[model samples]
Target: MPFSVYALGLAVFAQGTSEFMLSGLLSGIAADLHVSVPAAALLTSAFAVGMVIGAPLMALLGRNWPRRRALLFFLCVFAAVHVVGALTSSYGVLLVTRVVGALANAGFWAVALVTAVALAGPEARARATSVVVGGVTVACVAGVPAGAWLGGQWGWRAAFWAVALVSLPAIAVIAATIPAGRSGAALPSARAELRTLAGPRLLLTLLTSALVQGATFCAFSYFEPIARHITGLGSAWVPALLALFGTGSFIGVTVCGRIIDRRPVAVTAAGLVALTAGWVLFASAAGSAVAVVALVLVQGMLAFGTGTALISHVFRLADGAPTLAGSFATAAFNVGGALGPWLGGLAIGAGSGFRSPLWVSAALMVVALGTAGAAWTRRSAPALRSDVHAYEQGSSDG
Candidate 1:
């Protein structure tokens, strides 16, 4: 992989830390802002809402600009918003900042994924994506835990400030390494991009992405509560468990990247199945501390490992519009992000234990598994194979 790919990962790490860090900080935030824990948890949903809106809007806004420039601009905005979030004591202002920060974060992801694949070319597309998305896994391992620890000691505001500070070096690295005008394709007209994105295959793939992500977040968004109430772990142990989950994710993504190009459908289906099993196991064994930890690790691996194949599958189905396809994928993921947490909150409020979300997650993954199985059956069609071949050829030629 190119050094620039790692630079993109660094940017992702900074943004992802901000994104996932909230899961651990929800209690502190609720108390500090004079809100209920579930209400404070809405901040996660608010960020996802911003991502769902921002992906296309930011793509359109930056359509004419170089990918590098757009990335830099977005990262700066992301950092600034984190600073705003850190300084604000008002809950309303903090909520607004999460949305704005997520807008910036969404733009960065859209551009970063496209740029990573472009740099690596067709042959290494999945690996390139894994390398970039690895930043998020690393954040789960290191950054999120650090933020949680910081919040535990200083306050949730300190966590936001830490993210803001982290973004500076990421910005500097991206500026110094990523070359201008060297990544991404020429911007197509809005009409053309929309038409490409509207294809049935791409749409189905996007739906699969949404379902899979929703399943993961349904349980994951409330992991802290699950740890406390279900596993009987203290607050200090939550970050370490999260790190174990992240480690599993790191391993999953790495393995998926190596084989996804050869067996995209099979790999995705297997991941979904594993994810379903993980959730089922977690739900069944919620009372056992060891079982809960093991199941979380398994869930994290399957959930995140499937992401590379899903995105790569979308890129293949996209025909000629990878950037827009990427934006749509990002939007779909966030749509899941927003819905999962909201639904989980409802379940919890309705007196469903924290384990309820795991069952819910398992059910959602079953749906995603069906979606993946359907796509697999279509994979052998002559027309689809031809299109895939053409896409591969075009990518290589470019």
Candidate 2:
């Protein structure tokens, strides 16, 4: 709620922009570097893999530092990597830059998130966290499209340069606004929280989260190529399409926020089923530009809707440990982020064509749907039965 909280969100915006901007730039980067599109796509995976590995590791390594200091440190490193990435001609060096940038972004996220919550105080934790998350959504809606457009005009390296430029201002904001102190309250050590993840219900929640992300990104990571090769769109349309996808995501999260708490399991199940259906239809429809365009919005909506509900469920399951919840959610989603692009890349590399990624997306959703069903039958059935029994007894007394 405070200016400091918003400043933290600004930092998050810079990191998220870099995280997602690569999808739009993949084609250009590939052609320029003389690599296949699939190979270039691995940059997304590289960044995600780094995030998966970096969040907790960076958090631990900087556990003693002031939150503001850590935030500046990470942002500076993030900016530096982008500069290196932009300057490099070699695909391999660029790939390494993506990984390094992600590590820095992951560390900044780990530190900044708790700092925002700490700044907002205990009762407003979720709201504060949402401010940070809202930054990512805005990055999707605004930053990604702008990055794509910039990449289209000046070159892909321009997008990387743009991220570095934005991060500098963000760094300044964080330095000016965030209070210098211990990043967050000392709570249960991450070691103690490991036991919480062992629970079947929590694992199912995380699995659903991972699968849904993987499914969406399988197609999404290649949206540019899909537009170019499959839909027959020019480079100009790619940025607009990416914008539409991002708009759908913003709307999906907003829609889910209204209803997830009341029917979390049901919403997740329905979203997974719809997303699966959407992907299958998309595979069949890829030749039709109109169909492909329309389905992008539908697919985006369903994917984020399911994903939003799953994250809420994750927090609910890990309520007692904020640090654990944050790190676990980051790791789970990025696992999907990393895996989705890599798997999709493999499909493309195998000469499966662009449609293959759509099939891959659908397959992942099928697995997610199964996981949702297992959670419902295995975890919710007992609770449902008890509620039914109480209702029956009350009726009999009446």
Best by TM-score: 1
Candidate 1 lDDT by residue in tens digits, 1-398:
88888888888888889988898799999998899998898898788788999998887788677878999999999999999988888999999999999899988888888888888888888888888778989998999989988999999999999998888887887888778774444667878988998876677788888888898888877888899988899988776777888998888888888989888767887787778888888888988998988887887888888977888888778757756777887898888877787778788889988878888888888888777766666665777789899999999999
lDDT of 2: 0.80
Candidate 1, residue 117: how far the Cα is off, in Å: 0.4
Which candidate has the top score in lDDT?
Answer: 1
| Candidate 1 lDDT score at position 262 | 81
Model 2 residue 141 CA deviation (Å) reads: 3.9
Give the Cα-based TM-score of candidate 2 against the true structure.
0.79
Instruction: After superposing candidate 2 on the true structure, give the runs of residues whose Cα lies further than 4 Å from its correct spot.
Output: 1-5, 22-45, 63-69, 84-96, 112-131, 148-157, 176-179, 183-186, 225-236, 258-263, 348-352, 381-398
The estimated TM-scores of all candidates read 0.88, 0.79
Model 1, runs deviating above 4 Å: 26-40, 182-185, 231-236, 382-398
Show the lowest summed lDDT stretch of 10 residues, model 1. Answer: 180-189
Clashing pairs in 1: none
Cα error, candidate 1, residue 220 (Å): 1.4
